[model samples]
Target: MTVSPSLSLAQRLRLWVSRPAGPPAKAVQFDRALTPWAFLVPQLAIVVIFFYWPSAQAVTSSFYLEDPFGFGATFVGLDNYADLSRSNEYRQIAGFTAFFSAVVTALALGLGLLLAVKADKVIRAAGPYKTALISVYAIAPPVAALIGMMLFDLHIGPATQFAALFGYDLRVGIDYWDTAFALIVISVWKQVPYNFIFFLSGLQSVPVSVREAALIDARSGWRRFVDVTLPLLAPTAFFLLIINVTYALFDTFGIIDVIVKDKPANNPMTLVYKVYLDGFKGNDIGGSSAQSVVLMVLVAVLTVVQFRLLERRVHYG
Candidate 1:
């Protein structure tokens, strides 16, 4: 193709960019084929060492009853799995884990979106407002749980003291339901900033022209948001839904550990934490390995379902 004689440099550049018919090109090439493998070896080694190795060992260990002190093992076949299937405590913990994950993901995503919308509308002191909101996420999960413990510390905690005004006693770390409430609150608080950052970025990425069209088409702000903004944000929302579910399942271990304070006897715990407790504290390696395998399957199934079914409604622009 030939450029017009009158075309400016910027117009010429645009024409070049728009001309898309071409084979793919590689930017970098290695003199030897082994060079590419050399570059990949480190990352591949790390994945094998950290992920695949442990997974294989866990699968092997699950079928055997081994001494906690590194002694000989007896093959137990499916006994460990059978024990988990029949345990009432394991069923209760599974129920709590499902409830906890659902509640935390919902509250975190909802509050994050709400805050992002409000922050997007702020013209003055936006930096400080966002900084204040985002700083909470920088605190580690265990640290957040520690702060939560203090807030519900029964005697001098402001939250605990405030409960006295309503003639209600707040007994966190003691009462099962109260401790669960604290766990949910801390988990949501720890996760909201991450969700907020994503939601705010998604909101900001809406084209100004699209916003103007939406405004003209729908006079009501809520209607415009529901009809226009939400569809555009669907991809981001779907991605965050997966991330938040995984976070609730695995990343909240520190928070639960700190809240329970090494004593999970009377407190609510997630399945992941129960694995650690049984493995390390109770010295039941075979059972913990079996539990870990079950969790791995559960997570895999959940991910497949999310991708296969839940992703149907996500419309990416």
Candidate 2:
């Protein structure tokens, strides 16, 4: 390629930056071997400090019962995990966590996909519509929880009043299942916009020529979508599946914290929140560390399974 002599330096620089990348070479050599390390070191340092170091510390702590006040620690090998296994409350919370994660992930993904498909087809006021749909995502989880609390408030909340019309009392914090319902609704609502943004982008990235071909081949709209459009979306769907699961597991901490008002008595809560309550509030440092290690292992295994099993079905276009 030849540069235009008339072009300004800034314009030339922008052109170079925006130039399309070429196919990979079979073999390439760097002038300096340390050059790669120069670029990688900063990211490696961050990962080591933020992730691996903490993970190591948690594993160490999990094997010992530490004083909450940092007075001392007793080496109690595997007792923390054993306690978790034997405790009925821990088991119950674990069960709830699984159910909550599944429900929230499903709802968030399904609704987001549906909305994205609709938004992609919109011909009028698309900008405002997309903006309105995604605006909910900008709100913090705690704020969303606060909003949910007000909406589900027993006396003056619209949702509560609406439920009353059907002769059903919607007591959010007071009733276990009602609180779980509120938590799930708010969590799903918060997550849907993120999934929508990704799904919309994925839909838009589908080749127009491919879409035309699918249209010509399939007489039924649903058939065309299921056979062509859906397969094309498999990669995005799989990516979102992992993300949604992680979000449901860990990112809903603030939402649960705000809604439960720091009192987790008989209310539905996930494992991440349980770790917080145990470590910070209950001051069971060792137990919480054990829980954290458990979560880390669980997430890691889940990710591996997703890559191994789910990726087989994902046909990357």
Highest-scoring model, TM-score: 1
Tell me model 1's lDDT, rounded to 2 decimals. 0.86
Q: List, in order, the clash count of every candidate structure.
A: 0, 0
TM-score to native of every candidate shown: 0.89, 0.86
Q: Give the alpha carbon lDDT tens digit for every residue of 112-218 in model 2.
A: 99988888888364578789877888898999999999999987899999999999999999899999999999999999998898888889989889988988999
TM-score (C-alpha, index-matched) for candidate 2: 0.86
Give the runs in model 2 whose Cα sits over 4 Å from its true position.
Answer: 1-49
lDDT of 1 by residue, 1-317 (tens): 22222332233344556568865456674579788798899999999999999999999999999998888899999999999999999999999999999999999999999988888778365678678877987898999988888888888788888888999888888999989999999999999998888888888889899989998999998998899988998877877887787888888999999989866998999999999999999999999999999998886677567776766778888
